[model samples]
Target chain A: MIHAIRARIKQGHRTTRYPDEPMTLPERFRGYPRLDAGACQDGCTKCAEACPFGAISCKPSLSLDMGKCLFCTNCIEACPKGAITFTNDGRLAANTRDGLVVGPDTERVLARALDNKMLSLFGRSMKFREVSAGGCNACEADTNVLSTIGWDLGRFGISFVASPRHADGLWVTGPVSGNMLEALRLTYEAIPAPKLVVACGACAINGGPYIGSPDVCDGVDWTLPVDLYIPGCPPHPLTILDGLLRLLGRIPEK
Target chain B: MTSTMRTFRNGSALPLGDVPVLETESFLKAILDATVHGWRVSSYFGLPRGGGLRIYCLMSSDSRGSLGMAAADVAGNAFPSIAEFCPQIQMFEREVAEQFGVVFEDSPWPKPVRFERRLTDRTAAGCRTGRPSDVGVMEYYQVKGHEVHEVAVGPVHAGIIEPGHFRFQCYGEQVLHLEISLGYQHRGVERLVLGGPHPASLHQMETVAGDTTIGHGLAYAMVIEALSGTMAPARAHALRGVALELERLANHTGDLGAIAGDVGYLPTASFCGRIRGDFLNMTAELCGSRFGRGMVVPGGVGFDCGPELAETLLKKSAAARTDLANAVELLWETPSVMARLENTGPLTAEAARELGLVGPAARACGVNMDVRRDHTFGIYSMAQIPVATASTGDVHARTLVRWLEAEKSLYFIDEQLRHLPGGACMGKSNGLAGEHIAVALTEGWRGEVCHVAVTDDAGRFARYKVVDPSFHNWPGLAMALRGQQISDFPLCNKSFNLSYCGFDL
Candidate 1:
């Protein structure tokens, strides 16, 4: 125990001071994507064709759906016109589903916190029940990491409860598959009324890479009414925490 | 013995027509003989041929460092079950039957491998036979006694982990039998990868079991490169090796921490948890994603390591290594942690070998089998790390083996980074050779990850089989739980940490 204490003391304060202080992300960290429609050559469908998931649509203007994007930057490489680039900003979560869509003119898409009425109920404390429906476990793993001492999600009054009965909302990850659809619905129903559904990662919002697979239901929006969409193949813990904080009105909307 | 089966080296693509197609009886005899003579079945699956199924078995001769492939065409809807002679092939046979509707005549424990609903729907493209039962609603082994009781634990667990059903028949606190039923995380990964290296194939491979992204990604990349008759650059191989070892370091650290947590040891649990994140952050530094998702591509790695980044990695890994040693030493020294781990969930070497266990679980049982050493590939062929093992075959053995391996992995990363080859991290991959079969094995942090891809005449994948180590080790976990305390199930389960989705797939 003494040795552990000594080790802990030596590795002092590993936790990131996010919300209160800015977190330093790596240089290559792919986050919110920026689109330049004018840079695209007329009638070129390179970016759309390059996307593993149909996250990009060329014919209807160069729009990148952050919800479906894996943040793999495959489109950026395939786009000879340099039409799409990812900004290092990790705050890509949004309150509405349509808000996740990034057009050429859109500079940034920030997650708006809940309305004043909803905030009053869940603003101070929000416990979530995480249900992984056909998720790859990446999103789930990242979410669990938030509970670690470094992230200390409990510090923000956001905790993942074991039982749905204790939850104020459902934090759903993965593309909802036919097998998990019933269980997911049952889990959502188990939560009390006036509950929120926060879909984390690209798979939950728009099926990410497993987009058109018949096995999956595309995203959680096909079943539950998603209140928040956190995008990434598996969004970093910082991104997930930022979204949850914004949802609970803990972090001020940018 | 070698004359009966055709042999090929690891990562070599053989012409589809070159594999010797033996008579059904002879094929069965050959597989049984190989297993009896110490060769293990690496992969066993069926491919569609002339509206029927052609069974292929890939056996690995670990000592010889060669792989054997044998094939047999099913005459009708049923094939003779070799699983009785070679118990290791039972699950593979069941999987083949579940997917292709081939009946294994008079086989013991014949049941659906994944209990997939689509496999029962006749309208489904690959539904050759069998009706889909409700997932996790199958007959389980029961212990009938005055005070015997059955405890059922989730397809939805209390912990923030993936879903899988565990049924334990216990008398008081002692477990008589544990049956693991998993299909909950099934997302038709194999079905999704059928036609071609579809745009989503690489991404699907990465998520086969999300934790082993680099492992599966490396295996799939090797499969593509093998089939295409190309090799990744030396620098690319080095980068892949770095990523793979980093993955091992992170996961091992986390598993050790989780094991400590399961036993109620908080210090190591908390400290190792943070250290695990440090390793993941190092990976994020490499490829911008914590899980190393976008780091590995087909031809080579997606990211490059320059001198400055290499120096940073070396420094960070050195720090993590020191921190991990300090944290994990506490688990070894503390008597409470030691008591909870030692002799709990003991899997004998005999049982482990018979069950065809792979990875650390097998190594913990003193089985000297590691894909990286046995089937050399990438930088592993150039630089070898000693395979760590323990004879106890308990939670402690698994824990110790992981720590030792993590130490080696850290050393490996430091060495590789300090002497990183200066060259392109990717190479040109031409179109795959048509009508060929390729097998690629990677020693993923968990265990051996095998990817076998067979191409059509048009250079597209006709059949792709992924054998996650969890497929071989989940049974070992079940066997370990026998005659043990029921409460230790979580500890035993963590020691293996088998992937439900990987197995379900």
Candidate 2:
């Protein structure tokens, strides 16, 4: 196996130079949703309608409640003028639950300060217990790939624990389903007292495409409490890595 | 393609007699008889759908094909239990009885399937009022043993594996019975796909089982295309074949590494892991995603491999071939690895066929039922690769077969790339019409993924049932692990790598 070790070393760090160099995310990588108000039509509410969770408010002005946005591209895909696009920049964090509302910026400085503090609060070297309520398995695939020999997430000191009891954070994917509600709750409850729940995908935070499923609950937040919401249909590995480091207080709060 | 499917439309029923279709009890028996000659009744289920009860029976005859059903027009009170015919059908029958509230006449054990204890008493009933709770039907057969110790392992495990509960009844590591409790990670993926959006909306269906994504997606898309009577372009088909072969290579490499790890061969584990990583990177380079995601679409592929990626792939394919060659040599040459692997988990060819095993597991036990060769699709028939099999039916034989298959996959990938035709990838279609069609057969990596899609008049989905390969292979894994020691369970399980979510859905 000396040859294998030498080969790995010669491969010379397969990981991306993220947080230093700009992340080279894959094409079609789902991240945070940004709405172009210029292209936004008056009272055209396809994006709001397409949202599995009622994350967008189509009242006087197009308002997006970041707390409830599932980050699924049904809205972006539904947008007539390609007004809505999923931005790869995933630097969203907040102190209070209400601090995560992303609409017309009001009290911007205060919200930014709170988000920075929350990002700094959690430290580096993270541990996670990933919970899937009702996803298509895209997020889970990327998550598994993160720890493989190529990604080697263990080098970053980020490991996926089997038990929630031993975890400091919960990485939840998929839309919450009616069947897995009990299991999800028990898993979250099983996590220790001082734990955080990071809603990984659009499905978890909002409902993604399966919002009104009869067999499944629309959103995970509809059942249990959520701390950090990482938006994406299935967020890129770098987006997840960035969000994870932000949670662990590694990156300087932006 | 050398097609194994020999369809008989107007052939006579095998059971020699037809009970009235409305006679639910006799009808069930008649269907079972048609499936097997002796017709040893295995299991039965009472499923409730469309405002009525549907009775289902699972049966086995000899060491070939067993039969199961979704019986129509059966009232809850009149269905007869087949527990006496074959004792193995007990679990399935109990599952049906609990979930759909089907009352079986003269069942050996009559208990609520989902609920553990009967809450006939007022106190238990009082606690359940006015509260919305998530509770599943819990019904299990109570088989008492003489000092049978129960060990409950987890929905959450120590390793970074998916959640599953393994309840083992043993006398100090010599296992008597193994009861698996799953549905912990039941994501309701099928349910989401059925009602939510268009079939094209869910690209993640391929990755649902992770390893079996290419196989499952190809099956699903083929069925969808078949129903629509549309075939993808030649180049798209070739790309799909390449993706499927790469998937097989990656999974086989990982499985070998895991098997070595289980048997305490750390060097082999590290070597396999490193090579497996390279294999995955090669996949990423080819498809732009590591797990081969988004490469497969309903009509055809989402992306095409350009000349640059093709050249890179060809080079990497050769390197992986060489790496696996060296690794296989090391595994076979090492004395300790061989000692642990040889004769560790042996399932006879008879037992394997009886259990209806599929994929590499069945091939290792001498069942030459490969989907690519027997029931050809995509570029498999044109490429003409041999269906690799082993007669030993041991862990060593399985390892050899897998290694050989990886070599074959490399060869197949190389061939597909060399003959890469230029054309449009996708085909245009207005989707499937409103007709029920049963798309059944085996995929390369997993055994069989059967998809039944029925659309309404307006092209709205009415009923879609996806039976994953894991559903058929889980029982096979259980059978393989029956007589083996507790330590051998991981090796046996890793040999199959059955998907919990795929089966649960």
TM-score of chain A of each: 0.96, 0.75
Cα lDDT tens digits, model 2, B320-421, are 787667666767877888898888778887766555566788889997766676556777658777878999788887888898888888888998888798
Cα lDDT tens digits, model 1, B1-505, are: 4787889899889899888899998899998888888899999999989888899999998899989998999998999987777778889998988888899997887887777643323234321122332666667878899999999987778878888888999999999999888877777888788878988899999999888999999999999999987779999999999999999998999999999999999888888888999999999999999999978898989999999999999999989988899889988888989999999999888888888999999999999999999999999999999999999999999999999999999889998998988889889989999999999999998899999999999999888999999999888999999999998999999999888878977
Off by over 4 Å in 2: A1-22, A27-125, A132-138, A162-165, A176-179, A222-225, B1-147, B187-211, B267-294, B315-329, B440-444, B456-460
DockQ of each: 0.53, 0.24
Q: Residue-wise lDDT of candidate 1 within A1-254, one digit each (tens)?
A: 78777877876778878989985788889988888889889889998999888888986788988888899968989999788898888988898888988998876757788899998999988999988878888898889999888898878878889899999999888787656677788889999989999999988898777776666677888668989999998998889988888878887665
Model 1 DockQ (Cα-based):
0.53
What are the clash counts of all predictions, listed in order?
A: 0, 13
RMSD (Cα, Å) of model 1? 2.2
Q: Which candidate is the best by TM-score?
A: 1
